[model samples]
Target: MTDEMLMMAVKNGDLEKASELFDRYHKPLYNFFVKITFDRDLGHDLTQNVFLRMIKYRASFRQDKQFRPWIYQMARNIYADHFRRNKMLFSDYAEVEDLKNKIAAVDEVMVEDERQKLLYISLFKLQPEQREILILTRFQQMKYEEVAQVLDCSVANVKVKVHRAIKQLREKFLELEKI
Candidate 1:
């Protein structure tokens, strides 16, 4: 169903309509959660939580708002809760971590070189804030304004971050070659 139709159904408090909406949104939100949290199990749980929040508050679903941003806002809140409960401890990131590490593992067989594996590893070392911009814009193909909404920043800020993140990624790979 179209978003407006979905909203109308939701407004009517129809459980089946809520089910359809959750099914429609599950995968993209799952991918978004994984890119941020770096844990498949946690990502799955968080995606479910997002849908639950939507259903729990279906009466408040806005007719004018795009469902995407509303769902993304749900995701952002889930992420914040995780970090808050963790006592803000991303305390030690000793090496290349989660998303980049997993992507590099897949490329290990395809690329056929230690050098490129090292380069992929270097990409993760960029600040998490920067990496997130690339994932949302480059990987997810989100528009600048949508990305800005997800990240809670301006469209110009999202564009600038994507540019700078790419530059930094390149610089990091080059520096790795020197090591």
Candidate 2:
């Protein structure tokens, strides 16, 4: 079933639908959180929190709304709240111990290379907002419209931000490559 259909079933009191959604989304959600936090354990926790909130707030879900953006909105909020509470510096460019390790796992067949590692490092160097725009648009493959909904922003704004983010990432990647 489509995510929207599954979510609507969840909203209509078919609790198993929530589990189905969980099965489909949990890994992607964990990866999203891991990319942001650079901590797998925390990613797992935040991912769980996302689904719990979904169930707790199921009544607020409109059957007509797209489920992907709705779930992403919740994920974004959870990440923001955790960042705010922890006073974490999202722009830190230091080799994320966790990220460095995961790079090899990012693609089993594509042997980890310096350029790919540099790209991931450069991505982490970006401002949190820039990094997020890139992750959502590039890695997550979310459309500008869907990203706008998740971010509560306009599509034009998201497009502009995404463009700027790619530019920044390119610059960062080039600068890092020189080192």
Candidate 3:
């Protein structure tokens, strides 16, 4: 069944279908949280929360809408709530030593290459908004239209943000390479 069908089943009280959705989305959602927060344990928790929220707020699910963007919107809200509750500034959270420790704990496959490690380090260095846009558009491979829905912005705005983020990432990656 398609994700939308599974989600529709979930919304209609056939809760067992949620497991199929979970099976499909857990890894990508986990990786999304890990990439954003640099904390594997927290990623696991937040990803679980997304599914829980979906079940709790099932009534809000509109059958006319695509499931992927809707779930992503929920994930973004959950992440925002987490950020607000922690009251952490990006500078405070992105400490070099702390990031290195967290990144070291990330899955080996994601960090096996030296260049890939450097790229992630660069990603972590970006402003939170820039980092998120890149993760959503590039890493998650969400199309511009889906990203626009997830972000509640225009496709043109998403494109502009992506372009600027790539430029920033490139500069950060180059700076990291020099060190």
By TM-score, the best candidate is: 3
Q: How badly does each model clash, as a count of residue pairs?
A: 0, 0, 0
lDDT of each: 0.72, 0.82, 0.87
Cα RMSDs of all predictions? Answer: 4.0, 3.6, 2.1
The candidates, ranked best first by lDDT, are 3, 2, 1
Worst 10 residues of 3 by lDDT: 87-96
The sequence of per-residue lDDT tens digits that candidate 3 reaches over residues 1-179 is 99999988988889999999999899989988888887778889999999999999998998899999999999989988887787774323556788667666654546877777888888877887898899988888999999999999999999999999999999999998888
lDDT of 2 by residue, 25-134 (tens): 99889878877655577888999999999999999999778999999999988888887686764434355775555554443422377666676677766787887888
Residues 14-56, model 1: lDDT tens digits = 7678777777878888877665554577779988899888878
Better of 1 and 2 by TM-score: 2
Give the clashing residue pairs of candidate 1, or none.
none
Model 2: runs farther than 4 Å from truth? 89-111
Q: Could you tell me how far off, in angstroms, the CA of residue 31 lies in candidate 2 after the best superposition? A: 1.4
Compare the candidates by lDDT and give the number of the best one. 3
Q: Output candidate 1 Cα RMSD.
A: 4.0
Distance from true position, residue 175, model 1, in Å? 3.5
Worst 10 residues of 2 by lDDT: 102-111
Q: What local lDDT does model 2 show for residue 25?
A: 92
